[model samples]
Target chain A: MNHPPTTATLLALLATLACNVDRKQDDVPATDPPTPHVALLTSGPVSDAGWHAGAYEGLQLIGDSLGFEVSHQQTRTPAEFDEAFISYAEDGYGLIFGHGFEYQDAASRAGEQYPDVTFVVSGGSRPSANVVPLLFHLNEASYLAGMAAGAVTAAGIVGMVGGVEIPTAKGTFVAFEAGVKAVRADAAVLETFTGDWYDPSAAKEAAAAQLRQGADVLIHNLDAASFGFFQAVREAREGGSEAWAFGMNRDQNDVAPDVIVGSAVINIPAMFLRTATAWRDGTLGGVAEYAGLRVGAVEFVPNPAQEGVIPPEALARIDEARQAIIAGELEVPRIEYLEPEDDDPPSP
Target chain B: MNRTLTPVLTATAALAATLAVAAALLALGGHSPGAVFAALLRGAFGTWDRFFSFTLVRATPLLLTGLAVALAFKARVWNIGAEGQLHAGALAGVAVAILLPVHSPLLVLPATLAAAAAAGALWAAVPAAMKTRMGVGEVITTLLMNFVAVFLAQFLVQGPLQEPRGVFNQTDEIPLAARLPALLPDTRLHLGFLLGIVIAVALWLYLTRTPGGFRLRAVGASPRAAEVSGRFRAGPVVWLAFLTSGAIAGLAGWIQVAGVTHRMYEGLSPGWGYTAIAVALLARLNPLAVVVTAIVFGALSAGGGAMQREAGVPEVWVRGIEALVILAVLTVDRSWQVLAGGGSRD
Candidate 1:
């Protein structure tokens, strides 16, 4: 009968004891200031071996090359976003990267509060004095990969499997369709979005449906679901149909080497390194940082083992287009999500 | 005298044993257990700011939902649809807050929260009716309703309730008038925490002091006995538990949006409805104890993030440790009941 009250008291007492222990530990002051700390916050686990993993790699690259202390926290909820940002900033982290577009609002709020800390968000739309959006023009690389798909497809049909119909994902498909038409004016392109980023079964089902409709070359912008897309294409090949797949996000060319013609790669580690170095030199501007074919951050990397998979003529054309994009001669189509800024508005 | 002391000692031993196992596991993973535990404590209770801003804010939702679960379980209603009820409430709350034209705080806040509670009650009403009228098992129906609620939320956010920009898969922020007022200045803690505490005390009083509460508890203890001895049908009590539980859970969802996020988005709950089951069980279905248990869980959640940041432990491992703690506590509670010569309370 009295157990519940006693148990509650005991639990409360234990919590208090733990708090006192933490306070005692905090009493000891730091003898020396630690090195400049850089932190990364991701919404998903880094073990996904794709988008999140790439960001984690970039964090490690900054730590290894720039000699900065590094930390990473996989935040699960939006409520944790502000907490993580404040915690890192309070601990003297000079630069903190919120690794997805969802971090944009939180980063904007945190940036205003912690003016000294530089907050970078990938695929972010909002940009403030300290909140820089790391926009990746992966559509440019997707266009090149589309050109390769158009060349490699003997069936005169290509497919694009994507996760989510967001502007960014749709932009890649738009550029990819244009790329295919650029190479083959009459080529039929198929596109499907599974509405989920990590459902391999849905991606595979979409891939299979595309393959059934005579798409021999396929490209996918999915995370863990890309495995299902690749599996579908491999199954098509295994069934004695000529099939090939292109990888998206990071250098996934090695993932399905036997069937992969190339991969539209994002050099995330290099971008993180450059961003960190810029932050150190005080050259990281408030404007959204654009990294694309021009900056060598985005590329269409053809598989080394499948050197001759793409027609030789198509390879030359891809190289030409790459150079044109880098030289600002050819424009790859994209959806602009960032609003135009009027002036350097002062902070409220 | 010895019996009262034995249960306390057993609970303490179980907790110590769980910590030892957790420490050993951390050491095996090449992390200093002391540093990790210290980091967790500092993250959760390191300062008043951290506790109020992070831990309490995180606990608000869990506290409400835990109370909801406890209330339902107390009446032996077996209502497992709190998750769906939460989603339904959130969607309804957001709809009212955004669409309602009255900009006054008095009109909008209460109306929005009332709509949320009604929507939640309506959601649970489906399963409650099924169980009462059709003699269907509520376990399956309630659980399945969760999926329906989630999908409905997704559709609404993507379609009807999508922001005017139509770029992100979320609703526009609720107006300032509809937002929960801040309870603590300069902290994210909002009126929701106080609301939860108030609801807990009210629920505790209702469950212990009211005649209706006695009838509900009697039916929960033994429906046949209640029918014969208490002379009351259990059906009405079950319905009451279902609607009340759903209403509280619904409040948890909308309060989270009003107080913390200020915007409705997909994945807002982070499985808090499901975790409420653990919270309710850990509290032994006591309304007041649920408040304490919810904070403990909130600390674990807040500290789990720190374990990743400061301790360098991965999230998967932190979750494993959380599961271990829950298991240990339940096991100890079960053993205490057995030692007390109480054969199956359920």
Candidate 2:
């Protein structure tokens, strides 16, 4: 809006000048430069207790462990992606971590321009020399969550609501299906993609659809949409049903603790600490890092509160499944639309 | 009769007053206002590439959005749905680009653009229908429809039209054949900017020299006066204006999609519809003038990222600066209008 248009430009201009000078200072070759700063960018609010919140936690960990001066901002557009990266690069920040794959292209371009600066995009393709795609291998935990869900579901039906069709997210769902069938050969699994990470309405609708289809246990990979899926579970249980929901992406049991049986969680803070350590020691660049369960990146925790809700045999089966997965004797089936052949449930 | 001096002088006086207030606020915060202004100038126009790319790229959406609002306002219609219209247009463009074997950039690009315009126009027609046929106030209806449109876009990408494998809810990258070539060889600025200027000029000519344009203005001034002239129906004129605005706004959406994003996402616009209101009003609903004001808004937006990157300032500060500027511009503009008393000021 050109609302008092002149006043805004002039004021913004003043700040822009102070910033650009810092950029120029960063560009000059010096024997010693100041300690490098890092910036974190997220597409959604940090309080959502899922995708964004996990990323924010990683950022905070980086600050605490590495002592890197950090900055963060929530962005609302693809255009802001380029702007934020360029600004960080020009200002001579040593590294910038964009917390989503959506920032891959922007980070790639900015990385090319700023050679001294390293750019990391979580869940993005490795696009350039200084850009590294840091992906989470969540199948390890999803498989674990699937075991818990399979044991607890009385009707032998489990549901999944996925957000968007990305490879990593698909991989987790695939492994999860394997876990479900590991306990019961005839277990029926239903999966639907809501095509968005943040649409609560669509997520709720998908959850309701699965419930009506007789799936007593539900899980979702959507970021903000997790709220809706959990809400549906809470309502179903509150209305005198024995249904449950598993939280995905982050540990969100606190979001609906009473009905949440367990959560498939990614240790994002650990990942960030590892990456920052690598960058600080100059051992990171050019390659994509895939962190899975063995490296302490993914895990599944059975809800202590829901321990008595399952029968002794079911609980025993879950324990067996967990041991097999941990001991490398079980391979969870992966759900990837990109690879249709990945349908066979892994042996637990 | 003496128009030139009043506009230029009043505009200058207004700018100074707003600056004083902003500077005072900055000083109170123990920050040097002068340093911030200087940084913005360097960031926005300091380097030619920055001006060519960041400033122009930001301006592209604003120019189209401003023109859309100006055209509607001139015909006595209020359009508060450009963001929704833009999303509709982008979605249509994406659907067509993905579905068809659009192999050639020349043919595919135009077809995609046309699809966007049509989608936008159709979306606009709903509110127009309510106002023209059912005696509904378009302001509320148009605003309300925006939420529905945004959620619909979200659904289409996440459910029906999602890319395979379902990790993220964004559409696939539009075919290379459907992409817009950069306006400059090296910069991110695309030809959509040139297109926006052309439309602005065309609308200016239509409003000033064409009879239909005159009738719309008459209606905007007073519908009874337009009815007495009997040259055209205010209903159709406003409907055309509303739909045309939607089409243009839709085109803006595709411009961002084709030229910048290269794909569709949830947030295709950051309240471009609302920003357009300020752009159109600042230009006094003059299409040609809107182009210039939109650019100013664009520069400010473009500078926001620079502020964070360069000065170690937070993103919140850049947003705060934008809000302050908007208030200053509105205050100065309103007071200037009162002072000018219907006089044309530069």
Best by DockQ: 1
Residue A122's lDDT in candidate 1? 93
Best by lDDT: 1
Writing each residue's lDDT as its tens digit, candidate 2 over A212-327 gives 89999998898887888888887888778789988877877677789888888898889888888888899888678766676778878667776765567766876676677667
> How much of the true A–B contact set does each candidate keep?
0.44, 0.25
| Residue B162, model 1, lDDT | 93
In terms of docking quality, how is candidate 2 classified?
acceptable
Clashing pairs in 1: none
lDDT of 2 at B279: 79
Q: Flag regions of model 2 displaced more than 4 Å.
A: A1-32, A111-117, A126-128, A161-170, A190-216, A222-240, A254-256, A304-329, A335-348, B1-46, B92-115, B122-137, B140-171, B175-177, B307-328, B339-346
Per-residue error for B49 in candidate 2, Å, reads 3.1
Return the TM-scores of chain A for each candidate in numbered order: 0.92, 0.82
Q: What does chain B score (TM) in every candidate?
A: 0.95, 0.94
RMSD of each: 3.1, 6.3
